[model samples]
Target: MSDTGSYNAVTWLLDRNVDEGRASKLAFTDTVSELTYGDLQKQSRRVANMLRRLGVRREERVAMIMLDTTDFPAVFLGAIRAGIVPVPLNTLLTSDQYAYVLADCRARVLFISEALLPVVKDMVGRLSDLDHVVVCGNDAHGFKKLSDELAGESDSFVTVPTHADEPAFWLYSSGSTGMPKGVRHLHSNLAATAETYASQVLGIREDDVCLSAAKLFFAYGLGNALTFPMSVGATTVLNSERPTPATMFALMNKYNPSIFFGVPTLFSAMLHDEALKHERGGTRLRICTSAGEALPESVGNAWKARFGVDILDGVGSTELLHIFLSNSPDDIKYGTSGRPVPGYKVRLVNEAGAEVSDGEVGELLVDAPSAGEGYWNQRSKSRRTFEGHWTRTGDKYVRDAEGRYTFCGRSDDMFKVSGIWVSPFEVESALITHPAVLEAAVVPEADPEGLLKPKAFVVLRADAKTQGLQEALKEHVQQKIGVWKYPRWIEVVDALPKTATGKIQRFKLRDGAR
Candidate 1:
């Protein structure tokens, strides 16, 4: 290897932080521990040394099932430094789900947090390609102890020379409908995302500290909790638990972060949560961002009215890494997914593969430098999605005359009722506006003749889940939205099923388990 040949994504981020005089700056924090840029850089190098000592080769995948804790980024950055492709698995998933991904990726080493190791360790027996398991918490439980081993390793390691186009990391899709697909990203995508979205759109500053309701594993959370903040040498708050409204507010109070990233469901919960209503004094949040699911207009408006903060919602996918079409601070529309960011090009394409005009709904396509290489082991699906210079987002949207895009629903999720098209997101947004409604999901249910009609699976307020609430909710939708688009059937459940990132599983509702 040449003395100075390549730009490693990991070392570049660390060097940028050091060069900007942020060596002693707070880089990551949690309930139990905090780490600075100097600490992170040193620990990440030690992790790389540990991996090399374990005989892990360049470009080999190191899969992790970890929380949004201090160890997540250190190990992730270490993989990037060593030119190892890091595969961050969703922390909350069934053993079968973990088995599917671990088997698919054939990851050489598996690093699991301590709390989860007991349940997941048995699966290692079935994984023929897995060579070792390294636990991330205090005690390793007979497996390799990650923190203990790093303590003995040297804190100096040379960054592997990887080309710009080579694979750097892989984020598995949320798999709300089916098995997860790995979205592979190149080495250059991370830096480009920081330059375009974080710099131009969000205007992130070095003084800004970020807290994300989305975990570190999801694409949105990874950018918010790690890449975006670290790009400007900013600090990030890490929470290890699931992103309940209670947990989020606690982090906000503890960290007083300037930026809070969340999904629509959490925003909805916080708006109606009794505990948070009385305590909204000093979060110091300048602006809030929402993604992973479309932020319902009702939820967005309620959040602003309740908390005095505007939530800028946007559209992004695992393939694009982060938000490409987003609502900026100065140009936020409560109901629209704002215009494209500086370095991204957007297209609304119809079924004929032609661009749709303003006021017409079509599938959304985004072309960005931060786009992923392709899905792993799925050639045909990759060909359909990862076209040259563009990625099909699979969500349908309508563009306004001013170039603002309103999210309709997933292209596959859109249904027809009596020869007219119906967007579940539109109806779901309307359903959520009802006073008694807390959360909602709309899907198509078929009859004997195979004709489909809109059906709603709802989670009502504690007192409103009583008898006859279904008919009232149906009428509420009829009044709020189009009469024909109202749900023909309604079922009230205790909670809506969601992915680890809080995206509603509408497909589960379609299967009639509710």
Candidate 2:
């Protein structure tokens, strides 16, 4: 845990909010309550005292399964103050998925809210390493009540003196291709992203109120909802409910946040929402960021046309923490991911590990201080993913001479459609441009000739899914982007399967589930 290359980020992230005289400023707000910077610090300290009293030691994993509320950040920051590694779990997971993460992390203690207590109890017996369950809202059965315990504790615990390289937290990857894997992150990682992307690129300030459609468990949301905001003493708007088009619109209208973060899927849903059609302009968002996947240029343009704000398409992974490459407000490339952020380096490498030419598609490798401590417990996967200081992002991209990047697809997402290689993103991007299509996901289906043919599952605009809409979509793709790039099969669906972070799960389509 003593691999120190940077400063203690818990101090760097939160303590400075106090020192900078933002103590009275609102730190976070949700349906339940609001907390100022002083209130957050006070609550976090109490949480730290409770953990220390319960014998939770330095670097021990303390898992939390709660919705996005004020208490979520309290317990999160509290665990870090005590030098415990807090593991925030995806709330939209099944019992088996919860069991795997609880046992895999060897989490000694788990904090669950009253709403999800039943689900946690169902799999509690399977977690051999879990010694205690600190219920957040109500009776704990045989476990302890976290609220009551914190109520008695003094809010004056000292922050632990942990080095920057010490593991501070864990976020499971958004298992798009397979089972989710735990990703270990250092205390310094948050600072790296805040300084480079949040500070240099987004220019978040103390007055900015940040709201993210993506939940906090995922890596992208962690930055948009907490780390990035906390670093600059900015306020964040949180919502306990799931992020639907309605919920996001309500949050934006209610909070009037200056900076808004959302994924492409939700953005498309907002575009198709009848209620939003009557709304005039962007609520209060001056800066809007899109990640979790490569956003289609068509969606970005549509949003810009309606809301009068540009969506900065960026790329990052669990392995690299948050966005290492992105487009800035001043340099919005409509169809391309912008240059690397200030604190990161990027290279496109070919199969033989040689740097590819600018226009050629190659695997993207990124180097940044925000990079994680490799995959948890999987030594072989860790070695392959973390190459020295660089992370093998497993994404293919093409860079132009101007240093702009265009995401091709996941290396595994490309296949031969008819004796020719095709990228699903290329076709899906084109499919979304059609007037009737709201969102599209393309997957390779095995054809009679043994070639992997492209098949599209599309969500059409409301009231646009007529009997002959499928044929229209196919014709549109053929006419706009090359005919060879068109999907051989098209199915109109109400929605596409997505991860907790709003990333389309293409693997499920490949497995014949969608």
Write one digit per residue (lDDT tens) for candidate 1, span 1-514.
1224586887667767987788899999987888899999988899999889888999899999998889999999998898998999988778898999999998999999999997787779889889889998888888999878888999888889887888999999988888899999988888888898889988899999899888888888888999999988999999889778888887787778898898988887777787678757246888889998888877887778877888888878899999998998899888789999899999999999999899988999888989998999999999999889889999999999999999889888898888887999989888888878888888998866878888888787865646677777778888888789999888778898877777787777777732
Q: Positional deviation of 9 in candidate 2, in angstroms?
A: 2.0
* RMSD of each predicted structure: 2.2, 2.1
Could you estimate the TM-score for every candidate?
0.96, 0.95
User: Which regions in candidate 2 have their CA more than 4 angstroms from the true location?
Assistant: 1-6, 138-142, 280-283, 418-420, 465-468
Candidate achieving the largest lDDT: 1
Alpha-carbon shift of residue 370 in model 2 (angstroms): 0.5
Q: Which stretches of candidate 1 lie over 4 Å from their true place?
A: 1-5, 281-283, 447-450, 465-471
Clashing pairs for predicted structure model 2, backbone only: none
The sequence of per-residue lDDT tens digits that candidate 2 reaches over residues 1-514 is 2464435666777878998898899999986789999999899999999888888888899999988889888999899988899999988887778888899999989998878887878778777888888987767776788878888999888788887878899999866566689999988888888889999999998889999988788788889999999988999999888888888887777778898899988887788788777664346778799998888888888889988888988988887889988999999987788999988999999889999998888899998889999889899999999999889999999999999999888888777655766778889999888878778899998777666778999887766747787788889889988888888888878788887777777888888832
